[model samples]
Target: MQTAGSIQAQMVGRSGVVATLALCFIIALLEGVDNQSMGVAAPFVARHFGFSPAQMGLAFSIGSLGLLPGAMLGGRLADRLGRKPVLIYSVVVFGIFSIMTAHIWDANSLIFSRFMTGLGLGAAMPNLIALVSEIVPDRLRRTAVSFMYCGIPLGGAIASAIGALSVEGGQWRHVFYVGGFAPLILVPLLIFLLPESRNFLASTVQKEGRIRPAAISTVLFGERRTVLTIALWVTFFFTLSILFFLMNWLPSLLVRQGIKPAQVGVIQVLFNVGGAVGAMGFGWLMDRTRAWMVVLCTYVGIVVALVVLSQSGALGMIYLGAALAGLFLIGAQSILYGLSAVYYPIVMRGTGSGSAVAVGRFGSFFGPFAAGELLAMGFAPPLLIGAAVPLIVIALISTLVVVKRPVVKN
Candidate 1:
């Protein structure tokens, strides 16, 4: 690690969480890029291996599969091992596997590498989210989580922009090069600049006794928080199911629609632009009112956007609909994360958020595979309409009914 001032020193007066936010955003951005990066590269890879779109979809799903286990393991690791080591290990392992993905030649090796990358990527977040929530003051937690989630859109847009540019000459490998290299650049910065979360450290101690893993289990899964955590997980899982479907399916689906491959990236940009706007906007909204309320409304908006996008034949209408779909779809998912920060106390924060994210990760894993399966069955673009994404999310949000209780649990 670099010899910069400790996190405690940096967090001295008040500006610490801001710094933590920056780091968390970077981590979240890298995670998002890893998640969607394969989609942008899949077309070229399919052509190279003579694989069908369905096969490619399965491969993309494998990366998400890795995330499922990683999320579970990473969360526990963060609780037991301390957040810094877990984060560092994930970045290094994730980066190494990502680079390996660019080098694999056969389908099996490629799938394996992608899956491993998913594991590293999956492992990183719980620690990061857990760390970030605890590092900030209660008043800032929601906003901080919201801001970090914005990385999803920014990273997706980055992939689109990069893929669009690099794929100009049909050199898809170049896209992987950028994806694999990005984390490397951040690896050193993370080691040098980032500090261990004070809250996570403090969490090691409890009221009745010292911080035991059993205490965390009881506090989170005891009587009250378990159902709430499950609801949060369902909310994210459904949101991701549709979100991943769109991220991976949109480009190929547009291609099948007779839209130019080049223009597909442009379409992705519209969706991501809307996502950034929605996430940022929703984050601000969460601070002012109940997170569940904001998420519920966003889901409704997404349903409307999807319905319009699915049916609208006009390009302008399609753009507007996709953008609006992204706005609701991405923002609603992020709002739950904001809720996680505020809903749990500092001690159980990582375990709380980690459990939700870990469970939600299966959606990330299954989403692309389902899209691929649907497409393989010769599904029509309109049939698999954009509205499907938000529809699933609406069901998930209905499960997360948070009471407007106040404790300031600081």
Candidate 2:
């Protein structure tokens, strides 16, 4: 096994990279469960509190509100305070609030708790990406980063299964109860299991003395790196918009098409399952290529799948189309993350990725809400197809930018 010093000699430090990433992945795994709790628990929580669908939607939107600030702030914190500390603090804080959410008795309390929990939730993601980017060597960075994201869908998958089987098993508060304790269980493991981001350590320290963790920078985004940032964020934006529309809208569409509720649940499971498959496979493929062709194609596939799903008559075909869309649509966007670590240097990695992801979160914020509003308006399939038109345009834009110039700076 290569030591950290050896990694410095080569592009990657092999020894700790595997272990550190595993630790990050595990932490992210539980954190993933935490992330999906709101959506998974929304219906039950709304029933318990007598919340209207609109109110539940607003409750969900509040978290995004926190996420907006958190994304921007987390990027800066990861860059400034160091990835490990920022992640540790954020994870612990989120966990506490998550547990507290289970106890909330009213809409005001729940919304306030969710918003606070989201602060921690929103804050944690950027640093997690930053940490992954910092530890892996330059060549393997993309592959490693992609692997790290597998935690997201894995977490979501676990949530899906729990959500599906336990779909209506208990009070929705139980879901939050589950989310709260999961990360707390990881706190000690993270403290001991996960070390500081290696590059974060390297960039800040020297033979002279100890250095502050946040004061480091990589050469990825020097003064020359300008145009690339814009392109990356553009891809990040539309890709998420595509994925969010499906995750949020597809179920209602299926219900509208006269599918049974149980089958709709099954489709949701497949959607998440396909996402897991895409992310898991993406790592191996990315290890082989630079352009991340899988991601580009997936965007196109998502568009096509959306069109197909819109018109699907057979239940089997509907399921297949949904799975395909999930596979490419959600998975393709995450591939960008994998690509981010590959393209950026360690110093600016967190900022670059977080900024792109932060902007993308805006797409996430509006995409689902807009789709739901449209669905409520009786716009029909054609209008929804029109909504999807932007994705095609975004795909072309991403293709030009990602192929020609992949990396960006904060």
lDDT of 1 by residue, 267-351 (tens): 7788887898888898888777775577667877878887887888777787888789779888876776676666776556667
Q: What is the C-alpha lDDT of each candidate?
A: 0.73, 0.68
Clashing pairs in 2: 7-13, 12-137, 80-214, 217-347, 218-347
TM-score of predicted structure 2:
0.85
The list of candidate 2 runs beyond 4 A from truth reads 1-15, 205-222, 249-261, 290-292, 381-386, 406-410
How would you encode candidate 2's per-residue C-alpha lDDT over 200-278 as one tens digit per residue?
Answer: 6555433344333332233324565556667777777777766656664565466567776467767776777787777
